[model samples]
Target: MCRLIGAVSRHRAPVADLLGDDLDPFIRLACEHKDGWGLAFRQEDGTIGILRGIDRADDSDRLQHALKHQLTDMAVLHIRMASPNLAVTVNNTHPFGDARAAFAHNGEIRPVAALEKLIDPDLLATAAGTTDSERYYLAVRERMNRGVTPGDAITLTAQAITQSSDLVVSLNAMMLTPTGLYAYAQHDPHSEVIGRRGPAYFGLSYRQEEDLVVVASEGWPQPAGRWAALPDGEVAEFPALHP
Candidate 1:
């Protein structure tokens, strides 16, 4: 399993500050998730910038510098622990998406070969690394290109995974679009609680007054306001250009 954090603030604020003492704990958790790590954020121009690596996120000097220097209204962070057969490389890091969007996933898909068959060959051709997460992203992109909304595409992807293997998926993922942010989690009965965080492992909290929204794999301990856990199977969308 992996961990992720995302935020969209009304005013530019340092995420490191908001995370507080949680930062060290979260980073420690990420260090155990040694496969890879990534961070993506939107520029003032709305262009997405991403930095990723196969090293432990807590130990990466480059990632640390980028995080300390870069501040944005919107951002996504991911820590990965590669499942068997998945390669560890920068390209395989989470928070993958194009200009119009960004995504981070925390889950594993079983029978990877079978799932690969459902993806469009052209999109797969563009793959920079071999990881189920990347395949899942491409699958969603292909479905969207064929006129499917992100929600519908995700549903289809989930359905495809179910058909390919009996292995259940506990997909905790988020999508950040020009319009808003969306998140979904699919947990199975067999899921185990490995960390100190409660059963509700993922949450998205926002302060409308401040026009700030935050989505994290685990909730922060401070700076409390209106933070809500996104229900399973539902997608939370925020307007890109708010009125």
Candidate 2:
């Protein structure tokens, strides 16, 4: 119920190139994914600059401003379609971060309140907002805090959550680390997404060009031979762009 975009490369380019200009494609997709919009990019100082709005992407002034002006070698963008029970508020937006990483998720876990109980209570105590997606990120970060690599943390967390929850649909997500971009895509064999959304829309793909690597949800238009799908049930890691 969300769409995510991530870009990282050796050279910082105008955000518009990865997203779009006046013909904003992500905003157009927001017609269906309209809940809130958020953008997080790594700054030159090694900190994050976050711009988010509790409005549809197509309607978000901040997104418009970012596309026009911002530049970064690393960025994450999300246009949300809130799960039925979650509120459409700023705190519940996608793209949450910690000291070392930023994360955004595209799927859901059933009975989120129950799922929260499975995450580390100390970290869960620090959750700024209530949503399955944020809880999932906290769970993974807790593992990373204990020295597990971010890529493995996501895989292990996804495997554990899937074992614990029934009727779970998908677990497609992306994470931004200082040196790499990480992603995983896993789903229930019986979930309705198989018939309703199909593989083309559910698969995560990226192009590691000479200068930058870009990953995004499937519905966006991609150039011929420029994209490759991340294998299901496996984590794909794209190393930082070359200087």
Candidate 3:
């Protein structure tokens, strides 16, 4: 399994500040996920700035330091634990996207080869690494181009994965669009977690005072308000700006 985090805010804040103490522990946990790590942050011009490395999180102090100091309105972070047959490299890290959209995912794809036929040529061309997460992102982009909304695109992606394999999956993903943040949690048949029968845990918290919204694979450092757990098979959308 892997850990993922994404944030959308009304104001730009240091990525480090948003991550806080959670950053170190999360990075440490990511060490077990040792395949690679990556982060993508939005630029004021609406483009994305991404950094990735094949190094373990513990050795990514430089990368983390840069993100901690840089501030952006939207960001996506991922630490991957490679699945069998997948290559480990910088290009394979999460938070994959094009000029407009970005996404991060945690899970494994079964019979990953089958989905190749379902992806778009353009997306296939953008494949920088051989990882299911990147293919998943491309698949979602293709579906979106076909008029599927972001939420529907996620469900469609899940359905497509089901077609390929029966592996228990734990697809905890985050998508960043121009207008908002969208997140999803779906169980993969091949997940390696212990006691996998319970509900998949994912949470989102918004601090109005800080004008920030945080989406994490697991909740920590309990905050004051009731933390809302995203419903299974449901997508949660947070508007970029408050109405």
Candidate 4:
């Protein structure tokens, strides 16, 4: 489980500018979700750039610097609360990807072995971490390799896992691609964790302004009227500016 924030803008801007007043509170979420942090953005050259640290976002000087210095028309941030048995390591941190795209997941799929079985062998060999989140990402990437759009890739992977795995708590995640940002939200409303964390635990919401669109996890004080919930079991795409 984790918290995520992502944005697509018409002009290059720092992520802090996109979050506005919500930045601090979002960072403070690391106080509880204190395992690792990561951020990914499109570089000037059009390649995806990522920075990750196995430290709480609230306390990481590196994160602080990036929040101020890094600027992009598209970006995604993740603060991880390591799932049971997952170690706190850089490789396990999020916003994982290659030059084409970046991804961060906010839920877990049980018996990760089952999900692993669905991934192509070559893709599986590239995994740098054991977290189900990584496998979940590779699953989507596998489909993308076959020419599927990011949103469809996510939906197909989610459907496949739910059909073959046990106890899929959620498949909520944000994928930042070369052209746009995609958010996927799918969770078991009746699950025990949702009951404990409240119905909004795995929920995702977005706010679209004239120049930018922002999507984020539920945790802090985003005004209900201003932020629209991204519908469950579906994917939402926000286009970003490109060279």
Question: Which candidate leads the pack in TM-score?
Answer: 4
Clashing residue pairs in candidate 3, if any? 167-189, 167-190, 168-188, 168-189, 168-190, 168-191, 169-187, 169-188, 169-189, 170-188
lDDT of 3: 0.72
Candidate 2 displacement at residue 151 in angstroms:
0.8
* Candidate 2 local lDDT, 1-243, one digit each (tens): 898888777877767775443236766999999999888777666666777788888887778888768877777888898988889998899888854888888887877766786777888998998888888899899899999998899999888888787657888998877767788887766677767777566678777756767778877777659788778888888766633
Kindly indicate the candidate among 1 and 2 with the higher TM-score.
2
- Model number with the top lDDT: 4
Q: Report clash pairs, candidate 4.
A: none
Q: What is the lDDT of residue 7 in candidate 3?
A: 74
Considering summed lDDT, which 10 consecutive residues are worst modelled in model 4?
Answer: 234-243
TM-score of each: 0.82, 0.91, 0.84, 0.98
Better candidate number, 1 or 4, judged by lDDT:
4
Q: Candidate 1: which pairs clash?
A: 179-240, 180-238
Ranking by TM-score: 4, 2, 3, 1
lDDT of 1: 0.69
Task: Count clashes in each candidate, considering only residues at least 3 apart in sequence or on different chains.
Answer: 2, 0, 10, 0
